[model samples]
Target: MLALSQGASRSAISRSNKARPDYRGSAFIADIHQNMSVTERGHFMQTKVMSTLNKKGVKAMGIRQVLPFKVLAADKYRAIRNNDSLFDLYGVLIGSCQYLTGIISARRQDELVSLKSSGNLSPNLNPFEHENIEYNLIFKLKKSGNGGKISSNKIIERPIAASIAKIIWRLEAFNEAARSQGLVKGKTLDLFNNLDARMCTLTKTSVKSFNAHLDSICDYFETPLVKMSNGELRRQYLRQHQLRRFFALLFFWQKRFQGLEALRWMLGHTDMSHLYHYISSNEVGDILNGVKATVIVQGVLNKDGELEKLKSIGELKATLAKKYNAGAVIIDDLESVIDLADDDDITAPHIDQLKAEANLESNLEELLKTGEISLEPNFFKVTDENGQVRETFNLAFQVKTV
Candidate 1:
């Protein structure tokens, strides 16, 4: 039945596209084909499916899911280490790598499984010797679709954060351990190879092993179950494809800071329209507006916020107050701003100006030069003469005292 529905959806898309070459409505249909509940697929042939699926798919994890998962995975890995359980440790390590790498690199499962020590997805230790990059995910094959043809295989390298690089290095060490145990021969062909089986590399069929490890970690962590649209609750399993959407959503939100062109290149897309389509139906703008409101409101409340003195914060506040008939009381609170941020009527022209005025990379470079911020593995620490940490900031522009 699922196969028939998938074929029907494909046939429908082909016919619809032929009928109207300019029609792009079927862009999200593939996502729907995967996410539609068994009951929903009964009506899969209906005209409404296209419209509903346009903005719908299996939900991806937000920061809430990602952070806790990371912490839990770390704890589990540490626990397994004490028992000297090599196999269990390997599971946790590979699972964490796959999950985080999916989010960080936005690479498809095929590409991820193809990662090797000397092939695609190679690591660069002395990246700074050439570029300023300390670590990078170098890819030998990129799946860039141009007019439905795969682009030439080229050396595509993306700078990964230090924390992620540490894990990749750990995976290398795990490979060495596996070799010592006679699990494999020389240099491993795949970074995610199954150590228990000699010369066996992880393929698309082997994805469950990765997710099973992730599930164990999440269950151990006692993370909340996700409520599905069908009114059934289930654990939020980190799937391979959802990683791309998660990356697109977060990158779209941060595109004001990091250019869209950069994201386009990182995603291996030949067309900007394909990248835009990824977020068009995904409520990307809504999430970003809420994020902006939170930042601006927090800046207004916290005197020490990174964006506290920005002119746009004042303008946003004033605009919210006038547009929503919100008194000072309402605009001042984070929750109130969140409530107001969803409305399509509220628009802040000055918010556009904020993007031009604030360049995060430049600000960080300046701060580093002036010794106001010291880089850490996970975050930037600001300290005083006594060496007591004053404030901490992450890439998300969040400020907190430790």
Candidate 2:
């Protein structure tokens, strides 16, 4: 009897131990479901509250403002999903625009007419002023999608609304930056030119492409020349002209205009002609020439040292090519002369052949001592400042025999 009691106790203990883990897992799953249910309920409640507020003619302004029509429509859809009875009422009200249109029945039409005549629709209404009433009603009807339009009309209009909002935001930011920086009002041209320079360099686009981009910016601001008075328009045009000139100067200074030297020369000469035709001919050329000479001298100095290295490399390569003919003048230590080789001539077939023959290895000791053609090393090592050697392998290049 004692042995039977021990076996039963052991079985009970084993069952209790197995049941504890299952209970813990079930508790975990229940907690997850509870959390999801709370989240869904909270969202539904918030949506319902927002819809109620919108129906009461509340307008929310500022950056956080949502369109009333969209908020109400979303709430209606959510209510339908939740099988709420209020969804039927919302559908009926939205659908019954014939009553609002004064065409439902004779009695209802009479009532609507009476409401309009008595100014019940709008108190203190000027009966003679039909324009504003019509405009407001039409605008409201459009917002409510009463013109046989889908509910998604509100969502479709959002991008246009968001674009306008973004423009306002940028204007606010520009105003704040200008105020804090103590920027002068008349220097808009300078500010625009600086922005243009930065954008051109960053985007790596041409001047014409950059100008097209600027047109989009102006369009976003709604600052078209035709919209302003003659004086204001002239000012804007002059500012843009000055901005273009500034960009040209920036391009010239950055050596980007090197590819179009002839165009630069023409523009520099054209400036002199402008002064000559408007002011004096003889003095203009002399004055402009002085300014042009100064710019040229500055440019020459900036480019002089680099120009010397390029000329030296070009002459050396020309001499080598003439001497070697079809044979390769291998530069085993090519990297040492890479800065010189970057000149335009290195792209020539002869120079390319020489580069192809040359072997580039981190460890050039073997080729330097042997003085013969050798394959580049597959791996190399370099000693650090602490005298510890670190090894590296290169798979990009391998030894080839010709």
Candidate 3:
């Protein structure tokens, strides 16, 4: 029995390697490192989407849970507002700024800490602006190769909603007041920092301390338990990088408006594939199902409570016939078809399968409108799918002169 179990394990490993040829040799380690931005299980799984869907792993905090942590931070701030210790109040408010800025910018902690007030902050033009006001923050990406030159830095501007910006501004005002009282030294001009005996930059130790504060807040609120990697369970705590992941998730929802290219730029990623590694792939399945449900509810059902002849209906029938090895399957009710699909008994049509066929010209035009895809001249030397230089063709006069 032991030998058989060992053989079964070897067979499973062999099959896994065969299915994912990328994991065949030394490339397996590289792939794991590349996918580390996602859920921990994603290192071994075929795709980040599958790793997220597989619930029996180290789960990260969702947006719903993380949003409440902001509230908890607010409550802590309120509790300490009347305290005599300016340091305590200042620390709490600074932590709140970190949390808010972390989620909004989706930037690394070091980049976030390096934010300057002069070039970065552009307050709203209207003085009467309140909740609707937005402030633009310019982030300067750090480059070791550029010798700390501002001209060589990549600048990314992000507009932050006033509701959150107000908190950051409040912290800035408070820091100024403390500085006037000879509390903090004005050495580092970074937007966010802590005031010890002197003004100091926040480090990795400070992040860990902030996480402990989150853990304590969860204890006070009596939040539910979260599973630890070692099989022990504890209350959920927020991490700086977790905010980056949540921000990526938020960006995915607004992809139709904000688009993927903007997200890639904001995340400081040169490659779309790397940007995708940052996003939670499990949301793709949920969004696809949502599109399916919307089609069924609105497109398939009629105003008179009757089924209409949809292109999806014909497709569903053909899918069912081939799936069951039966001839001429009839779909009388889409509700029944949806139920069968839920039970994994039948393959039903979804929104994606109902869309028109793709054409290069139309796709390129749509992508250009969304600012997601662009064309380059021969000097740029863009390669084809096979990584070879594509031949340039002149179509200005409707002539294929390569």
TM-score of each: 0.41, 0.13, 0.39
**Which segments of candidate 2 are over 4 A away from where they belong?**
1-84, 98-402
Model 2 error, position 313 (Å): 99
Q: Give Cα distance to truth, residue 73, candidate 3, Å.
A: 21
Q: Which tens-of-lDDT digit does each residue in 29-111 have in candidate 3?
A: 76444333232222222222222232332143121110012334656533443332223434555566677777876766556
* Prediction 3 global C-alpha lDDT: 0.42
- Tell me how far the alpha carbon of residue 63 in candidate 3 is from the true structure, in angstroms, after superposition: 31
Q: Select the stronger candidate by TM-score from 2 and 3.
A: 3
lDDT of 2: 0.29
Best by lDDT: 1
Clashing pairs in 2: none
Tens digit of lDDT per residue, candidate 1, span 1-402?
A: 122223233332223333222225564455444433223322332323333332222122111111012344656533543422323444555676777877887776656666664323234453333344467786555453435565446667776776667677666565555445444534444666543311122222246655665655554344555433343555545676666656655643453423456676775567667754542323333233333333444455577766666554455445445534563333345434434444524343223222322332233233333334322212344666898774333433322111
Per-candidate local distance difference test: 0.46, 0.29, 0.42
